[model samples]
Target: MALFWFLHLYLSQFKWITALLQKHSEIRMRGIDLPDDLIVEVLSLLPVKSLLQLKCVNKSWNSLISDPKFVKLHLQLSTPNRNLALVQYDRPDCRVLTFPLNHLLHNPSTTIPTHQFICKDNIQFQVIGSCHGLICLLRKSYTSDHTNIHFRFWNPATRVISKELGSFQQSNYHAHDRHRYIFGYDNFTGSYKVVLMCSGKVKIFNIGDNIWTEISSFPRFDHDVSLGSDRVNNGVYLNGTVNWIAFQDDLSCSTYSWMQRDTTLEQYMIILLDLGTETYKQLQPPRGDGVNLVVPRFEPTIAVLMDCLCFSHYVKRTHFIIWKMTKFGFEQSWTQFLKISFQNLQVDNNFSDWNQYQTFMFPLCLSENGETLILASSLPGLCQVILYNLRRNRVERTKDLGRIWSFAKDYVESLASIR
Candidate 1:
């Protein structure tokens, strides 16, 4: 009862009188003194919003919550609860949103408003990637195309925004818009890093040192295999590693020289970067024929589902497929976990034929508990999001995002702040 009242009053509203009322004989708040360890443990388990509120509770609370040790420990204790996110990267309303998973699972019909972290009206920003709780934003420069792209790290929890102003800059980057950047956590060093890479150049920015170092080493290029250059790809950060969807040139059997004639299969692979080693490795994903993996909707989005790296593919705007990597670094372990058919989208949405027009859909994410997937499909000027229940194997709550949502991506909140 005391704890409940303490929290209710603590969160509902706290006044200076509330502090003065704690004038007990021992200078305690009605004998409600909590040890430093206890406070750390409790605060670590709380949500980021409540934790942010408690930072202003007192000097001691502020000091404890802001400590780097507490931030790391809190993130460790608060796994999976890292919350889901949505992003709108359109011209006028560039925004990123987030909401708790429990709210969607328990009270989905209640229409909970998402937390809008950033919304710049006229400026354009790309959500390069998100890890722990920090998001990497690449702001397109309007001044000069020759200047390096400006990247910023923003932690909504800490409300600390910092830009990477190092000397590292890309030359003639407009030619390689496919170049990507990822922000990931280094567990061994207890630090954060920004990995910016194109076809040949790779740079790493250490958050602690606030400096960017060029990485000369790279995954061996398959020069023999003919692959297309223009393709859309996204990065997925998992377990101190960042995985990017890439192609390996061809599906020819490397061991048998005669098998090289089978150039029909465009072999797709995962370009993985281990943050600890700051090195790169190429891993082949599950093999599939017939569909060009580099096509618009088929370019698999690397994602982490149920604590495993997954290849999320939207099959030409009709089917959603999830290929799970059962064991790390093993290509044969890639197994097709789920396949949901959206063939009836035309009938359901009252269209004559779904495949007639320039179709589009992006797999937003798998739900926190790995129950359903949040899918967003572009329609004319508006957008729609639907939750596909994996267990039931059906779609529910066909949500119309009301015409403004241009893009969506999965994100989990964390205490990761930029120094």
Candidate 2:
């Protein structure tokens, strides 16, 4: 009878332990349920790689990560706050400098230093554009043979890179080939497109389709003279159309005049290529005196300010002028909206005396709020990036990268992981 009692006690204890373990397991599985938005916020704060892997956590998470809305939200949250880094890449040596946007907005009283990175050769740095939480980079062969312009789409946040589209050599496309320009798209149906200008032809590559096509002909420029190397600046993406600044010059003149007098001597026109229609139309700037104003290119042409098409012109030894499109008809009037003066810049050095000839060929990016302009200037041993805040009327030097092409590996790795 005693043995039977002991056996019963042992069995009861075993059963209790088993039951406790089962209950604990159940609690762990459902541990502390969180609100959906809070969970998304927390997940967004995590590195993209971690977030991607967490997609397997459950069906809900998998769906969230794949949703376009979530992708945009996560990108906005991941965007660095009040800071823009100016990176210089020069193959083996690289440098990065960070500047505060707040200073550019309120104080304008700081000079940020640059940072460095080591990278390989043969990596060409091309800034496609920045959208949402990502910037697109196009990597091409560093050589000047005009032969192999292989393109890759990269997302810096995820460090993911897309497969190379194709070789320029194989496609009969050359970067220097006149009359040809190249453009890229993340999605053909998407809004973003990169326009590449070559010698005689302009090639438009839709990011959506990842295919290259030629712009058979451009609106005839009266003069036989060639287009400027700064064509990238002239192309603006707006309302599902890519607008290019076209100059009709006096082909008869020995020396083609650009900003010489700005009179109507050379007709300056704007051409809009609707991505949807795949057709081109011409528009004129309002009351534009083609003089002293450097034929602006690569400046932000499309903005929400005043609900019109805007173009920014940075004149030599003068303030930055903003021209707004009043009417979309054949007689479009470009009214001067804002003029940012040198005194308003509040720089230690006079901006007018600063060599305006030393301009870098990168696009000016606006902040999320659409109130600031990001400018990058590169000199022999020093490279500087500044933010000019329109609303606050201040300018701050945010980054001072010493060398160009210095952030190659970081850029490459950042792009590679995104894929």
Candidate 3:
């Protein structure tokens, strides 16, 4: 009876072990059924934060997420379609708002009012520019003793803020004032730089290293004749260099009594600051009536169209001309793309002051497949943003964001992946 009982117990134990083995094999087979490509596709769509968190799920997943090829593929898949929203801030107590890019693109007749958002009171930010789903912010602060300025690299979609770069400090020189012009990121350095122009001195601040380096090589023109006050017409980052148009005085016209030189013809020069060498060089504009062209109003009037830089010029009281850079280099060709007269649009009133709204308006940065120009107009009580399709030659009114200080576009693709 004891032998029989031992046999029974041994058989039962063997069967139980076999069942457990079978279950483990089934689970392994199920995991193998999932294709590698499918896993990659699904994982690529998840935000970077989620991907980073999932690294601990398994060894395969960790390796995949860290793969350089996967990162590139994820970024390509997540590129945001270029569409911009112009939010308004009217009431002192109003909140920040966000609008959809599709609504602005498809519905020409649809006009949605600006909605409010949280955290407007605590953060004072202005959109300097956008690139690769990242928006550069100029954060300003006011206290009792001294003023503080910082450049914040932010991702609007993910709400990720990089470490703030405090006031740039360097030996032998100080920033002219706190009201310095902070340009967006230079692609070469993958960092933001500021141009400090005050008291006849110009300096640059590299936000990545928090270093204030002096730009002593820039040609100095008399402060009186230079376009110092014309913030919009001053310095613009194009192709790699900061381009500034200034008027140089002919010193020969000095009367000796006041030491004032006679005004010469207005010259627009392209100042290229090589990121590698940290130096500035002047490039002359293409020969022709280039110097004869009047400076466009100092507003956010310049935009990147295709591979060229474009801007609108008030040709006459009733006409506007669009100019485009045709070739690269300082002496490259600049051709007129469009000569638009008010009569061409059949508009009765003259748009003489159209540039006034340019400062408050933000461009809807569109991808190659998106619309050409997106702009917002801020009126006294009511504000409207308009999107212009260059390919279709159509203009449509977008949502009516109430009074807003500044606005930007947060691309959906920008949130995908942890980077």
Candidate 4:
């Protein structure tokens, strides 16, 4: 099935090339020659790997492939070829792995080859997230100030990386600070931006700008109260907004008190930060029938599934429920999408010591036809990538991608340059 789609798209591009060639004979009599615009239209349909080799054909083609407009065009056309981006750590070394989704879906039993980007730096960095083929890496400064953070944007497909952008300092840092950051694209400004949320204060850093602008602080909340993958406060980037599932609290409730696990007065809400407006908004999360919306011990995660915001949380540590927001910014559009039992997911069923070894399942990506969903079942130090069939409601296959440092994201290859 994957091969058919690739052949279909490949043949479709050749059809355009054939038609253009046929028209060249007729247009030869006219004064106008075959324009480069038509050539660019066909070239954009090819894969990035092919485009890189084609650059050696002529200087004109090399210049055309490097243009910003061509980069955007290629990105728009390469949406169908999504890959899984995984960051695995082996002791002190880190590796960024990219596996083509089509290959994995087609050959479930085979060990799919992955493209790896080895980080040789002495300092370890974490993948904040990916946007427009750019992976944002975060590293803490080695200096004495514990509040300082540095960022670097790298295009794994293009193999181009920008210089260390910042050693920006947070207003105040604590040992318990989650210090989460999200990378997003601002459609209004046609640029990329990174937003950092820590200590109830919010800051925005534009990609090209060498400065950080402090925005409205997040509603007073505990740093440990945010629900996300691997217990990290990761924001779901979708449609120019970064969304997180957080518990809202009053100033009277201190962060230290949160360690006591007292949640009778706390409330969970979805916080949205608009990259364009640089402001914050709160929305209520999904509420299901006979479902308790509060879970103080377990963490609920927010992810983008089929371009819709999805909320997933474990019920009594026995069942996992996923809710999808069909319409953005509309609380009424929330719908319960999936409810799978722990037995079905093959998760450990040790109920006596469940809290200590609880597993969190996150929906990483959905198939093109939407019949299958890839999930990351994260344990204490291990992560398993599972292929689940939604139509059949069963786990089709599960592969251990080794001990991953963070959850995987959908990666698309592009000619995006961070410089």
Candidate topping TM-score: 4
Candidate 4 lDDT tens digits, 353-379: 434333356778789899988887666
Candidate 3 structure, TM-score to reference: 0.65
Task: Candidate 1: list runs displaced more than 4 Å.
Answer: 1-33, 79-84, 89-93, 97-117, 144-148, 164-177, 220-232, 249-266, 288-297, 314-318, 344-359, 379-382, 397-399, 402-406
Candidate 4 worst ten-residue window by lDDT: 258-267
Candidate 2 residue lDDT tens string, 1-419? 34234433543454422442343356458885445765566555544655666677668878987777777566556534433333456555333333445554554445443331222234554544433333444455544434455555545445455666634552344343333232322334644455654433455666556676767865444221223333234354555665555454333222235323333312555666766556778676544464534433212233323335666555543555667777643444767767776467543223232233224323245565777765544433335555677777776664454643222111111111223
Give the Cα-based TM-score of candidate 2 against the true structure. Answer: 0.62
Give the better candidate number (1 or 3) by TM-score: 1
Using TM-score as the yardstick, the better of models 1 and 4 is 4
CA lDDT of each prediction against the hidden true structure: 0.59, 0.47, 0.49, 0.69
Worst 10-residue lDDT window, candidate 1: 223-232
Candidate 4, residue 129: the lDDT equals: 84
How do all models score by TM-score? 0.75, 0.62, 0.65, 0.84
Tell me the tens digit of each residue's lDDT in model 3 across 1-419. Answer: 34234433543454422332344356567884445775576566555655666676668888998786886677777433443422334434323344556665667566555442422534355555444555555555556544456765555555566667655333223333324353544657656566665544667777667788876765564322222223223445556555553334233122232222222223434455655456766555433264564433322144455656554444333554555677755345677665555454333333344433334333334436644555444433335655556666665664444544234433343542212
lDDT of 4: 0.69
lDDT score for residue 86 of model 3: 29
Could you give the candidate ranking by lDDT, starting with the highest? Answer: 4, 1, 3, 2
